[model samples]
Target: MVSAAYRRVNGGHDLAESNIVIYTHPTCEICVTVKMELDEQGKAYEEIDLAEFPERWSEVEELADGDRITPVTVENGEVTIGYHGIGCMFYD
Candidate 1:
């Protein structure tokens, strides 16, 4: 069994059956780096351009507590604000 928090985020969306959401801009350097890593590791993810889906921006803001959230990486249900030191590993 998993903890309540873990269950809520679906184990950081690391579960094989879980789907990861990547909020990124194609021109973002950090997003590019993270995407490279994911590609190298053969990880699966779904990209949602914040520029295109402004509505989802509210969801991201809610999860991040209104922080300057970008390239928000979410696995399962867990939320990540940025892409500096953190990457897909948090979920893995």
Candidate 2:
């Protein structure tokens, strides 16, 4: 059974199924790098282009703790504000 906190984070989202959600822009270098890494690992993801859906920026902001950072990723409800570089930069 999932913990209460995890369930709360899940919030009716299918992150329990391992679906990853990436908020990105096509021209974002860090976004590209993150996608490439995920591709190399054969991980599947759903990408939402902020450039195309400006309305979703608020959601990104929410996930990023009010920071307007690109490439906000939500995997199983774990929010990652930016690409976790090889040196562990830009990540929580």
Candidate 3:
């Protein structure tokens, strides 16, 4: 389940000034860690669980252009394929 702190912005909904979407699986430690980091930073993000909605896997793959990896992040219109800890920055 996604944390209530993060809002679910999808289907062309208008996002906040900072919009972030993360594709993750429940068992991925990296995914959990990254979400924690985002929470600590006071950043809100929408989390999509591939395990729950396997149909969304293609979205992540399209963002990666073939490489499918966990912890895939999309901020605004920019896509990041992996976690980069606290140093990771999302652009608008």
Candidate 4:
């Protein structure tokens, strides 16, 4: 189930300021590590467990150049695949 929960800003529905999605696998240690950082930073993001939705594989496939990986983070129109603390800087 690819469920998402987001908050509205300025009492309006503006996706530009409130769109963050995280694609992750349940057993990925890297995903857990990255999530911890996000939590510590007080960042609000939606996590999609691919393990529940096999159909979403196509979505990940469209982004994958060749290698298959989880914990794909998407903010705005930009995408950062894999978990790395360096990329977390972009959130700020």
> Considering every candidate listed, which one attains the maximal TM-score?
3
Per-model lDDT: 0.57, 0.64, 0.71, 0.59
| Per-prediction TM-score | 0.63, 0.70, 0.74, 0.67
What is the per-residue lDDT of model 1 for residues 15-41, given as tens digits with 9 covering 90 to 100?
354376777654567776665666666
Cα displacement (Å) at residue 64, model 3: 0.9
Off by over 4 Å in 3: 1-4, 8-18, 85-92
Q: Indicate the residue-level lDDT of 76 in model 3.
A: 76
TM-score (C-alpha, index-matched) for candidate 3: 0.74
List residue ranges in candidate 1 displaced over 4 A: 1-18, 85-92
Which candidate model has the greater TM-score, 3 or 4? 3
Each candidate's clash count: 1, 0, 0, 0
The candidate maximizing lDDT is 3
> Candidate 2 lDDT, tens digit per residue, 1-92?
32222211222234443468877766678887777777777776767776776677778778767766777878776878786632112322
Model 1, residue 17: distance off in Å is 7.9
Worst 10 residues of 2 by lDDT: 2-11
Model 4 spans > 4 angstroms off: 1-18, 85-92
